[model samples]
Target: MGGLLGVLLVWRVASALFGGGEPGLPSGGGTPASPTPTDDGGNGVPASTVEVAEDFPLPAIGTRLEFKILGLGDDPKRCEAVGLLVGDDQRTAYHHLCGDAEAGTDVYFFLVRIVNHSDAAQPIALASFEMTADGGDTLPALDVETANATREHYFPERIELGPDSRIKKFVAFDGSPPFTPARLTYVDGTQALVIHLRGTWIGA
Candidate 1:
């Protein structure tokens, strides 16, 4: 009987530790996990835990942009440019918040939030993204070579966004002193999406 009791206690402990308890039951009555952190931390400043560029502009949250899916014969899907962050510190604590470290002074970080509003999934090719400045300079999306050199985080070659789903990804650009991008363009061979960045700039 003692042996059986000991086994039962062991089972209970294992279940608690391994999430084997009854469904919907709160373990230890603690709070649930929090959602991922966005750029806005409720205050007017950037939500980074590390030092950011002194003059970096913060894009207003909820700015919406639309895109058409080529070959799908569907209506345009909406993508919101949710966040914009730039800093020189490679060891910034915000690294985990967005997924990658900074590249340094020569490389700056740009984050854009893309949300799908269509009924079907939308595939985005990160490699096709381009940043254009008002000075007639066009910067291509970061490639493997650039990413390795900067040690900056980058998006996957392709990402599928389910209907009504959202994803925030980092896009690195080559610029010694960070400047506002005039426009962000994405070409997927069949269709193209152009987002004007004229009024989206907010100084730090």
Candidate 2:
């Protein structure tokens, strides 16, 4: 379902990418309905409801990226990817994980957060993140591991990057979706979180 050049594009995982009309009414009380969150496409994944102007300028801090964790426990130590759908498929595709086949490394989508430490409006082109499996020594491509620990938006899912920026690509990955990270050594300024995640084993 993905065949783009890879520039600045938006993404999502664990939820449906396409959209259509709302589902029909419950057949006399089937499984209870989940809460319709306001900050999302009304699915489990989170997306931005704010809009950016065309002439918006970049703020002091380039762009702070963040993410939401669902299937994990509260404790950070027990909050890591161990045995879940961490690969690309129909239902549970790891859509956020983007890589350059030409470069020979993969990046994983763990989380995205915005730290507005600016006084004026922080106009960011987009927000993006990356990860590596080789101790930051080399870049690696993600193939849906059993222990992935990141979450992001995608598709009709509504997690927008930018109309043309890669950090938050307005569209999905198409080979040139703006973001071409090297290695995920300094994810948002933190050390190797994926490594810590492996040791913590969230929900283990």
Return the top candidate by lDDT.
1
TM-score of each: 0.42, 0.26
Model 1, 145-188: lDDT tens digits are 32223222346777777878866555555543445566555543
Candidate models: Cα lDDT each: 0.37, 0.24
Q: What number of clashing residue pairs does each candidate have, in the order they appear?
A: 0, 44
Clashing pairs in 1: none
In Å, residue 95's CA in model 1 sits off its true spot by 12
Model 2, 8-76: lDDT tens digits are 122223223322212232234222122222243232113432311110011112223322111211112
- The parts of candidate 1 lying over 4 Å away from their true place are 1-105, 144-153, 176-180, 188-191, 199-204
For candidate 2, the 10 contiguous residues with the lowest summed lDDT are: 51-60
